[model samples]
Target: MAQDFIAPSILSADFARLGEEVDQVLAAGADIVHFDVMDNHYVPNLTIGPLICEALRKHGVTAPIDVHLMVKPVDRIVPDFAAAGASYITFHPEASEHIDRTLQLIHNEGCKAGLVFNPATPLSHLDYVMDKVDMILLMSVNPGFGGQSFIPSALDKLREARARIDASGREIRLEIDGGVKADNIAEIKAAGADTFVSGSGIFGKGRAEDRNRYDTIIGEMRTALASVGR
Candidate 1:
């Protein structure tokens, strides 16, 4: 694997102060700033958009913005995201009617293009475009909302995706998002995920039983991640 794991998700950040929140995480050495764009029709929750990415760039956020679009008719929105200065634009393969062309459009815009797979989506969906994209996102949880628990089955999917990438002979980056935390991060890393996305894992209020243990959990996650050469 690679020593580049921490991709902090902005979904768990205080959106009212998004710029400041982004700066804080960037200052903490976060590799990519993960942005989740949700449409109510596609995932039941509606969230940020291209304007936010433009705003982040205006605010001088230098970290690459990883845009994860959980919406249908994704083609209609890719251009706006690219124009908004998104360094990497990823769309759900299940949501697009023509995944190949959509990915090509993203690449043509001079940005790294990627595809996202919901937990229930099969690994084979990536077969055609597996070599064409710069990265592949495997959702470890359902995509609708933030703060959801990580699904363990996604680890098996990650393993399979790694196999696919390896067999394809392409150096595509593999990212695991949803319900990621300190304890299981190593599992995903061992499974060949170099990029890790943590929403509730890094910023959600810690478990009620743990009582104000967020910092501890974050530290442990970082330490474990560091050991894996991430």
Candidate 2:
């Protein structure tokens, strides 16, 4: 399995002070910055684009930026994100007219490529492109929104995706996004998720009052993850 990662999604962060929020979370031990790029057409919500990603780079955030594109016609925007300093770019397979080509496009632009599977989306999308992807993101809740409860069935999907990764003997990351909190991170890890994405779970209330607010939650999450194999 790849090293466990805690990617704090910026969707739930206070956008007015996003740079500080990201800096604080990373200092609190977050492994990656999960950038949720939602297009109103594809996911019913509009979110930040590559410009924000470029701004973060300018803001001096050096941690890996995991850009999750919840947008249709994903191919056209691949180069923009790569140029914007995205370390990894993941898109839903259904959004791309040419999944394989899109994956290649990301790599061509010098960024790692990944595919995301929504709660109901089948894993068959991985059948042909397993070798082409650097990561596999499984949405525990539906996309477009944050703070939704995790769907129990995602556990089974995680296990299935894990099996595929192990079988291929590839270093592909199995990432689970949405509703991942300190309380359930261990269960999710035990199910074979090496990368965890949390939005509201990490950026909960009390942030303004406590400069160290992220420390407690991130520490608790790490503590939970530490107990997974035991």
Candidate 3:
């Protein structure tokens, strides 16, 4: 299995102090920075673009930036993100007119390519491009928003995706985004999600009260994951 990763979504972090929040989270044990890019047309919300990603690099954050592009016409923006320092760029299959081409474009730009599947989106999208994807992200909640509960049906979906990854005999990572908390991470891991993305669960209101807030939650999450024994 690929190594487990705890990717903290910066969507729930303080945008005013984004650089510090990212730095602190990494110091607190986060593996990758989950950057959520939302465009109002594809998803109801509008969010940060590549400039913010570039800013982070300038801010001296060297950890991998996992860029989840929730934008329509994803192909045009692929290279921009790669230039902005994105280590991994994932997009929903439905958003791209040519899924295979988009995957190729991302690779051509020198970033790890990935395909994201929403709760209702089918895994059939992975049928032809399994070899091209470096990671597979499963969205447990609807896109465009943060702080939603984990959808119960996603567990079965995770198992199905895991089977496909193992069958392919490739090193593709299986990532789960949305509603991942220390409480449920073990169960999610058991279902075969190695990369966990949590927004509100990690950067919730409790952060303001505790100086080592991220450490407390991330440590608890790691402890919970340890119980699963890889």
Candidate 4:
């Protein structure tokens, strides 16, 4: 399994003060900034773009920005995100007309690349490109919005992805996104997700500037992860 990483999704953050939200989450010990980029055409919702990423970097957020691009025609935006200081950029394989070339483009711009598998998307997409990816993000809920319930089936998919990663013998992160919370984080971890993405789960009933609120929520997640012995 990959090393444990807690990536708080900023989708649920108060976008009016996005940079501060990123800062507070990291300060509370989140391992990565799980950015959700949704193009209305691809997922029925329009969201932050590369400029927001650039703004975060400009605001001094040096922690890894895990960019999840839920956009169609993904290739065009790869360079902009890479230039914006995205540490890891992953996109839906189906969105890219040429998946390999898109992955190569991200690497060419100095960013780690990966593929995101939606709830029903097949694993066959990984057959030829396994080695080319640094991470495999498994969405537990259909992408587009945050605060959705996790699909029980995703656990099985995480197990399958873990098996594939083990067989490859390459260091690849197995990330689980959507509806991850302290109550089920251990189960998710046990299912083989080393990187956990939580939106409402971490920002529960709190204002973005409340660092203590972030602290308490994140601490509970840490405790949950620790209990799983991962």
Across 51-158, the per-residue lDDT of candidate 3 in tens digits comes to: 999999999999999999999989999899999999999999989999999999999999999999999999999999999999999999999999999998999999
Question: What C-alpha lDDT values do all the predictions have?
Answer: 0.83, 0.93, 0.94, 0.91
lDDT of 3: 0.94
Tens digit of per-residue lDDT, candidate 2, span 1-230: 47889999999999999998999999989999999999999999999999999999999999999999999989999899999999999999999999999999999999999999999999999999999999999999999898999998999999999999999999999999988998999999999999999999999743667854698889999999999882
TM-score of each: 0.91, 0.97, 0.98, 0.96
Write one digit per residue (lDDT tens) for candidate 1, span 1-230: 44655788888877787787677666655678899999998899999999999999999998888999998989999899999989889988878889899999999888899988888888777877776798899998888888778898987898898889888888788999988888888887877898989877766644357533455655677787677643
Return whichever of 3 and 4 wins on lDDT. Answer: 3
lDDT of 1 at 15: 76
The parts of candidate 1 lying over 4 Å away from their true place are: 205-219
lDDT tens digits by residue: candidate 4, 119-149: 9999999999987999999999999999999
Measured with C-alpha atoms, the lDDT of residue 163 in candidate 4 is: 93
In candidate 4, list every pair of residues with a backbone clash: none
Q: For candidate 3, what's the RMSD?
A: 1.0
Error of 1 at 108 (Å): 0.9
Model 2, stretches more than 4 Å misplaced?
A: 205-212
